[model samples]
Target chain A: MTADRGRNRRTAALLISGGVLLALFLVSLTLGRYPVPLWDVVRILWHRFWALFGLSTPVVWTDAMEIAVISVRLPRVVMACLVGCSLSAAGATFQGVFRNPMASPDILGASSGAAFGAALAILLGCSARFVTIFAFLGAILTVALVFLISARAPGLRVVNLILAGIMVGSLFSAGTSYLKLVADPANQLPAITYWLLGSLSGTRLASILPAAIPMALGLVPLLLLRWRLNLLSLGDSEARALGVNTDLLRAVLILCATLVTAASISVSGVIGWVGLVIPHLSRKLVGSDNRALLPCSMLTGAAFLLLVDDVSRNLLATEIPIGILTAVIGAPFFIYLLLRKEKTL
Target chain B: MKKTIALLLAAMMLIALVGCTKTPNAPDAAGTRSFTDSVGRTVEVPNEITKVAISGPLAQIVVFALCPDRLVGIAQKWDKTAERFLATEYYQLPELGQLYGGKGEMNLETLLSSGAQVVIDVGEPKGSIREDLDALSEQTGIPFVHITATIGTMGEAYQKLGELLNMPEEAEALATYCDAQYARITEIAERVDKANLLYITGDKGLNVIARDSYHAEIIDLLGNNLAVVDSPSSKGTGNEVDMESLLLWDPDVILFAPDSVYASVGSDPLWSELKAIRNGTYYEVPMGPYNWMGFPPSVQRILGMLWMAKLLYPDAADYDLYAEAAAYFRLFYHCELSEADYDALVRNSVGKQ
Candidate 1:
């Protein structure tokens, strides 16, 4: 009866998440700078349904629709999904390893480090793709430093790790500030600022691929070890007693989380809220079982991001930064979390 | 605990008082301080303009044009070639950090350490900037002047700059020359029906100027019919029209720059679609120290307009293009163009790219 109850909850999560993604996909396809009719979108989707199975369609309207979907909306939606899932997965990994709910992808100074790297690349007048590579390197370097500095005892102390991250984050932030200082007032500085504000506007398929591969690799391992994450959540000693090598597990988890977080940040800029809120929502839905929570968080994060990105494109004549839109929606939810914390305390 | 609080409060009050104190003008040998500048304005200048700063390229350009000796700082580089060219001047002149979108967030300590005397800004006047400049003036006794661009109101703007710089005669000469050029361009432009002119560049992708822009106004002054007069977004200032919009608004006589339109469409793909391209009416605009054919109606632009009018309507004018170009430079820029320089300006066309 208990097993059946768990199965029912998982099925509900799957169905709800699947429905949200489908709705978001439709919204993304129809709503943009040039809005298309919902009926036309539906017609294209139905006609091109066979094309998905590698069969050619005679309808030319379907071809145009396909190009719009594949060329424009598809990459954007895929980017949103990849970024959202990666951030949430990394967030959950961080929260578990740190044994603190407040811990996020940025807690280890990944975002600031990436921002500094991006600024450096922009200042040098290199391609935007070079900025992504620099961001990844910065994130890894920051996390590595955080790990090295905080490795004082048998296991990593949560407070020490956070302090180290803050210090490193500030140092990297100073680097970003320095680049902004030296950058050309007319062109480079504004470009750097806009890039840092976190938008997915100027991404191409080639630029997206590097970030996607590492995130995919990191997420698979995270999903497979989701049950072990639940074990780790039951305090370090308890997790250790359950035949889990806590130190080794933590090392692997940190590496995966950093890689995935770095991958997402390098591609789409630093998008917040998904990492912090999605895991908490997943826990509320699936009763803190990492097995169910991880997949649920991934889906919810993807759907949430796609919806926000859809709003970003259509709501304003100019493409509004997805990061700004997410924060506007997420801040209220975060306030609720804080209020709930007050009641619990 | 009460004593400690009192001590902290006292320290805070002391700091606040220090901040509130008026910056003292240094006394002269006679012990009477007469705070005045070369402009003859009785304005106080601090003993030091330490933390000397500038905002945009225009700010640096104004300093270079007016008082190159007074400049203690500069901003970041854009083009690598431009950077190499400007490096000697840049190394000699310290940069006061990057100005964020002309929003000068000066590193106060770095600026102060440098012992800068004045901060010169050249761009659109911002509110917070005025406040900061006022505060810095009160705090450090450094004078800040916003030099206006001599684009729209050329003669008046140049005179105002002269009044600020204490160069009244040079200013009058500049203003007179600018006025003559403006009148000449308008008189010549009046004779032609507004021809469909597309000002595109080969360097950047699909970014074109509209009639509302400062650049467009110059083209309008030259008496040309703008292809895409309507812009996409009427946001902050200028509108960046997209590629699809360009296709919809077909132009007659295309005057494209080298760097802007050269990337995407080489050898003119729209040969059949465009009247200008098909008839070979498309002409590459001349680019030198200043891009002539690209409209934004500066003092240097008169030369470009003359060249463009001569190229597009050779029968319309019997004036010598070379002599006109040289005269315009001498009259406005206050520098004589050498024979080679005049040839370079004339030969430097959009077709060269």
Candidate 2:
């Protein structure tokens, strides 16, 4: 009876979080430098939705207003939501698979590798598309290299993988530093520095579309296997005794997590703390059942990043890098969580 | 064993003697004159200042204007395209890199070897900057002098530099030109309604020069800077902004930095929605030997002032931009702009609409 009550409460929490995410998304669409009245925003969105289904409607607002809402603001908000969802899900998976509370989405050097690739592309004067492609390739290659190295090592698979990630991450970071050193100080160096700090300032529908496919492909599998993930989080010996193929499941989870992380980083540079902090915050509310925890993390992360992005883009005329804002907000919240847990103990 | 130890000691002594005697020859300091520089440091500079090394790009530009011949080394090598606009003597000079802006790979060995008597830094000083420069001066034994110059104070800076270089006549000519141009702009600025202007920079042109930023001093004087953030960022790249904010500001005129999206912004659908672009008041800042606008914000900005004045109010500021540009190139860069060169530099850039 108590188990039934617990499940009911978890379901209620998940529904509530999802509702909050939807509300934030709608609020984000309405809020921007361009002051579109809420009614106008709703009308514009309603007209566009009908147009997508081959229906015609009279346009009431100016073309600039339409473009500002549909083209400029919509894509960035969507990208934020997508990135937030992917990072949070990946972070939860990594923490569960590793049986470590501290593991983030970049546990296997994906963020550093993606950063190096983007910097290199900018240094070479590649176009925006090539930069994203190179970043994606760099991430996958680094993860593959880490896996290969760790597989060769004999003992303590999880620890070996983490150590390998550190080695590979450091090497790529050093490479990025070298590129920054040689980049032209006037133009190229500033470009590289700003890109590294991470912003969604220049995102377009075209840029966001390419990353969306991979992210969706990665997310579906994660959602389907979430129940199995809970069992895998148990000790390997116990999970093996329970007839769970821990090795195969772990491999699949890692691959899905990498795909999501790399694709997200390619579109939105390395936004830290979301992937690391959001999952813990979700676990606090939903308890550690992966079925409940994973979905809750995804919703909470989307809402958190959306709110932060609104602040980043609208706090002043100048946009603050979203990574800096997340760290500023996340670090303090994390400390608060720790203090609260100690009080409970 | 005793013989080997004695031989080793003799070799070490010989090596030490050779090292001690191989120090690069310093210019004789017998006729040094102590002068209070812009930063109020009493630096003992050479009485007949000949060879000089720049501490960074700003210093390089200022020194280049006054005495291009005396520059022992440049902070960075000029672009090949800029070679035609510069003197041939400066083409072969070593690139000594720089000391500031986080690009610090200053080649001390090359600086010393090039026979530079002193290092000159131009611009406002930051925290503990005096101590830092003093330490560098003491370590390298090359007297360092700092001269602070803004858009308003170029004339005084030139006079000080002229006195130091013993070329008061040349300095007076440049200084007079700068003061007159600045005064004219200030007067015109007060009379006219300042055009709401936005300066966009960076690869994507999303970065904005917020109001009251050091980089946008020229913009501030000429127009009403539209990017009015609460706390203005001091970074060279300025602050980043989104398209929504840009649409909200809806500036009257937009100036694109040389390295920004000047080439593609005209056709960009979202950018075309801007009122400035729609009205054709947007322009790409002219670039040649150096950017005429605010890169380094040196004496070159005199030309920027003249160009902007003409571009903004064609009837009010009646001076021919071509003639002014030709004169600036000849005086500052020591290269005459031919009819073709002048056309190419300002082509589709200034007053195009």
What's the CA RMSD for each of the models?
Answer: 24.0, 25.0
Off by over 4 Å in 1: A1-7, A42-55, A62-67, A152-156, A338-345, B1-353
In angstroms, the error of model 1 at B351 is 44
Task: Give the Å error, residue A137, model 1.
Answer: 1.6
Please write out the lDDT profile of model 2 over residues A1-345, one tens digit for every residue. 988987888989899999999999999998876666888789889878876865544555644456567766787789899999999999999999999989999999999999999888877766566777988999999999999999899998888989999999999999999788656554457667766776666566666778899999999999999999999888888999999998888889999999999998887778899988999898888888999999999999988988888887767434567888889999999888877843210
lDDT of 1 by residue, B1-353 (tens): 99996777667556534533422332221222233322233444443332345655555543454444456666533223233223366435655544432112233334443455556555544333443344444433346555455444557656665665556786687677667766766666778666777676434445555565545656656646454455422121224556665667667777666465533354666534666656656666666544664322234555676776676556665677777766765553335666776655455352333
- What overall lDDT goes with each candidate model? 0.64, 0.81
| Candidate 1 lDDT by residue in tens digits, A150-187 | 89634547677788899989999999987776564445
Using all chains and alpha carbons, the TM-scores for the candidates as numbered come to 0.51, 0.54
Locate the minimum summed-lDDT window of 10 residues in model 2 chain A.
A55-64
